[model samples]
Target: MHVLPERIKSLRNVKGQSQKELGQALGKSREAISKYELGEREPDPDALVLFSKHFNVSSDYMLGITDHIENKAFGKRKPYSPELYAFEKYLKNQDFIPYLQLAVSMKDSHLDINSFKNPINKLIKQGKKQKHPK
Candidate 1:
């Protein structure tokens, strides 16, 4: 697994626990703490849960599977909304913007790249015309 050593270390620092203290608290050897912080090995199931609870983060965040760590009780990151994710993906996709522009443009609104009036070019021309009408 692509666990985050630096993230773990950051959490450890936040918790203000020394390696020996944290190892004792987690019921593991000090060397285990070293391994976890070095990214040499991931924590076991029980230890994984313990770490998540200790750091108040999602297991996915601790495992580096997701970049989000939400605290819905406190409204920290809003628990990683799939809708927001979809919208973000759509907004970032280059095709989506031109398609939207093409749909909105009243003057020959066709966004296909091969179209005679490219939607992006049409939008740009419209903007220029609006700004500098003769």
Candidate 2:
């Protein structure tokens, strides 16, 4: 699948936003948003900028140039700590599907990291056993 359409659709779904709502926010018609997500039409440069700003993501991410979402250069958020940045870099190098699934599960459950300890440890043990069979 083309990265742009999939990214747009996924972000919208994750945000629980309808195409009409997104279009209204971006000052485009709902049809335009639908077209953009369907890959039948492309957002102009200005609309693309609006999307990046609206979603607080980098334009490069919206355009599929990078997988990192935050528009560090455009936003006013505090700088990422060195350790946090390192962790994020490491995650970027790993397979993303599992992380995405974990994120969705966490969001749905409203659970904190502490709540995942047992499951995580079980997975770790399973991995070790698989690597060093009896």
Question: Model-by-model lDDT, in order?
Answer: 0.72, 0.76
How does model 1 score by TM-score?
0.50
Instruction: Report how far off residue 89 is in candidate 2 (Å).
Output: 19
Best by TM-score: 2
By summed lDDT, which 10 consecutive residues of candidate 1 come out lowest? 78-87
lDDT of 2 by residue, 67-131 (tens): 66664565644244323554665678645557667878998988897888889779768867987
lDDT of 2: 0.76
TM-scores for all candidates?
Answer: 0.50, 0.53
Task: Tell me how many clashing residue pairs each candidate has.
Answer: 0, 0
| Residue-wise C-alpha lDDT for candidate 1, range 30-94, written one tens digit per residue | 89999989988877888988887776777778777787766534657645543454466578887
Q: Report clash pairs, candidate 2.
A: none
Error of 1 at 125 (Å): 67
